[model samples]
Target: MSNISQLCVILGDQLSADISSLKMANKQECLVLLAELQDEASYVKHHKKKIVLVLSAMRHFAQTLQAQGWQVRYVTLDDPQNTHNFTDEVARAVAEVKVDEVLVTQAGEYRLQQQIDSWQSSLGCTVRCLQDDRFFASIDDFAHWADGRKQLRMEYFYRTMRQKHNILMEAEHPVGGQWNYDHDNRKPPDKSVPIPPPLRFAPDQITSEVISLVASRFADHFGDIDPFFMAVTSEQAEQVLQHFITERLVNFGQYQDAMLTDEPFMFHAHIGFYLNCGLLSPVEAVRQAERAYMEAGAPLNAVEGFIRQILGWREYVRGLYWYHMPDYKSLNFLSATHDLPAFFWNGNTDMHCLSQSIGQTQKYAYAHHIQRLMVIGNFALLTGLSPEQVNEWYLIVYADAYEWVELPNVSGMVLYADGGIMASKPYAAGGSYIDRMSDYCRSCRYKVKLKTGDDACPFNYLYWYFLDKNSELLANNPRMGMMYRTWAKMSDDRKYEIRNSANKFLRNMS
Candidate 1:
């Protein structure tokens, strides 16, 4: 009955201790392979913090496996025997240690999916790429939910999830008697409200070593590489989640769309990386936030809004990824084509809003939700870069830029490049929104309200220019009809001036 005939692959992101593969290990029979592949890091010149977090977590997980009496063939990026790639290293391990099958939880990426799926023939063994099963839903499970639906909506899917998991519910309904509490969550953060600082973890030696390696290897990559500190382990992830629910979840929804001065992380749970890398489960994160609300009568807006994001929006994004990818990544209904400005790479810019947003991106690789959606995404939308280019940039720039989730958020939700498939209409805007939400406008030399002038806000001119340029496509769309009507009232000469000013801004940027 010696069943030690299978090989289990433990990827860097697959550090979850409760993963079925670990519990399924036969101790003496199966070997878990964790390889540090060069291709993974260099694929996009990923952020330094992302590189350090994964490598450090992998080492710790390998030790956890070893302590549990499972054989772990841990290979470093610089290992002499390293094949320098994931599949090559996995194939090498499989051949050197004979196995009947290779078991794995699926990778949350398109590039790796093709690699893993094809390796079965090369290894001359069955490759059982099982579902990651870490999410509240899986690709298969989500597909099942999508079956026969005329159109998909996260609200409906999320309600199904709530019922299926019996979370935040009373008998058959959501506890608040309605499926949503969106109304309460829209209030901006009050100056009188005292918010707590984010939970921080000291960079242990393991993490510090990874940082050193990243610094040495990727000295020329875009974005900041310094002062990297956040969750790197499951314990750290849990502690961060705990702090979020107890101290911040109550206000998370209210200020979810609000922006504040000098606060990047803010009430936002910087736990996306943890959830993305498998340190935390989405359901647990949502459930805990819900629990905090019930126990403390936390504002319904705050609780409901936070719950909807994780249980509804995050899951919806994942399902959309599986439902449409490869093709989804290529959809550019708007047909936008321009270069992302040089200012995006470094924080060097005179436009205060752009400078501040880019500066935060350099410092922490994070921008609050509004800053991302209305400012960065809005700017990109108006300037009109090809969807693929903008998608690639977003995928590489953020801490949470895994293609599975980031693509739709960028090309579809952000750029409106997928037309109306992923969004009802464009999230178009002018600069006044940014002015209202941030202090950047005050410091900015450009005039936020000016549509055309030597120093008019490029955002204002570009905003009108984008709408006018795309009026043929957007004018009839119900979501934007009102705006288009307003546009129709504007003089033709004003439209000419806005486009002219926007052109100058782009010319100057280059």
Candidate 2:
């Protein structure tokens, strides 16, 4: 028996050079496995950029390891002998290589977690799941902090993280004698502000081949297929980080809430894919932003807010996903059952906010945070689409979406499906919210000020209907109760008109 000593499995996303799992890799002793199976890509109608980026990055990472004298067994998507499934592929590799030990970091999805358990029994081998130390705040560490908290707020968690990491701190206290400066970061871009051009890397032959493969194989998927960006390598991802800290981070905290016409990226840092796909480690990314605050005259709000996202919220969501797996994906507090509108796939809509947010996603496989939560997620919630269906749209559409991140954001925080685990209540509202935060509503065909007329913005009607329908589920929420009182004081005639206008808006092709 060959008794292959180690089975080193690399999932598509873990392509980092300094990953802890790669520490024990050896040429003759370990067998490495890489698979591009249908079950993984087809689970959600994957964005075109997502498919190309992952495949190209995986191919590049495998070549680097092989060049360094490691034995790699790469299984391509169209491998004639490929199983096209994760469990079957793991079994096949173990039997062929005669491996007795399986070594890997914990996976990023719940389905994969279950799959690994059964795979172990079939292989009759010892499987060791190492901690995914890429994140500064581990799941164990968060659990320790959440032990006695009555309500888990991101701000509170963010402050704790500031002290634990000693980031932005000054001699046992915060640098500016305060934990946050969010008020300082909300200025709109002005005459002096010119948006910096986004960082673009020239595509190498390796990434070009991956784009060609995705175009050929996944042409049926909805999204723009041409003008694919080359984000497949770690070096390019680091360059994107440097550019943001220097040219954009100062304005990032301010217009982080603003959106403009034809300007898809604005001051947003487009590194979610790189962070999620293992091209950039969380610590270094956070450190770079902090250094900018110390040395490069970046504002406190810009530095602290950017750092909180990575250290506080990103880690919080991942912990929540693991703490309530398999079940978290099924939450539906409002019990919505409507199909997603056809316009979501094609971005063919008169609603300027949705068009910009959803269309930009198809074009770039990216959206800034406010665009996602306020525009798209808000529309889905106000219109009564099922949270599960809404969650699936986000999972399929973004290059950075893994189950661990997507589920909590959609099902918990954005949708309020877990009732209160991720958020206190549904973030339901009208186009007025969009109008205040962005430029999208200004150019929309539907009148943002109208609530019950032919020219009424659909969000006005949907907001009332959503409140009426889910009143029983949400009336007592402390934050929402005041809104309920306001709705109760409205005349019956106006309420009737609003609901009627909402129904007509939903029914009409207009």
- All models, RMSD in angstroms: 2.0, 1.9
lDDT of 2 by residue, 304-408 (tens): 878888888898888778777778888787787778888988889999889988888899888888888878888888777788788889999988989899889
The lowest-lDDT stretch of 10 consecutive residues in candidate 1 is: 182-191
- The TM-score obtained by model 1 is 0.95
What are the clash counts of all predictions, listed in order? Answer: 1, 0
- Inter-residue clash pairs, candidate 1: 4-29
Q: Looking at model 2, how many pairs of residues clash?
A: 0
Off by over 4 Å in 2: 1-4, 26-28, 189-192
lDDT of 1 by residue, 1-510 (tens): 245688888877778987766666666888889988888887887777777778888887788778878888889987889977889888898778878888887888877888898987788998887777777888777889888877677788889988888878899978879888777655654667777888888888888888888889877766776777778878889999999877887678777776666767768888878888778887788878777877878777777777777877788788888887678888878888888787778867777877777778777767767777887888889888778778777766777668888887887788988776567788888888887766667777888877688888888888778888898888888888888787888888887787789888878876
Position 492, candidate 1: lDDT: 86
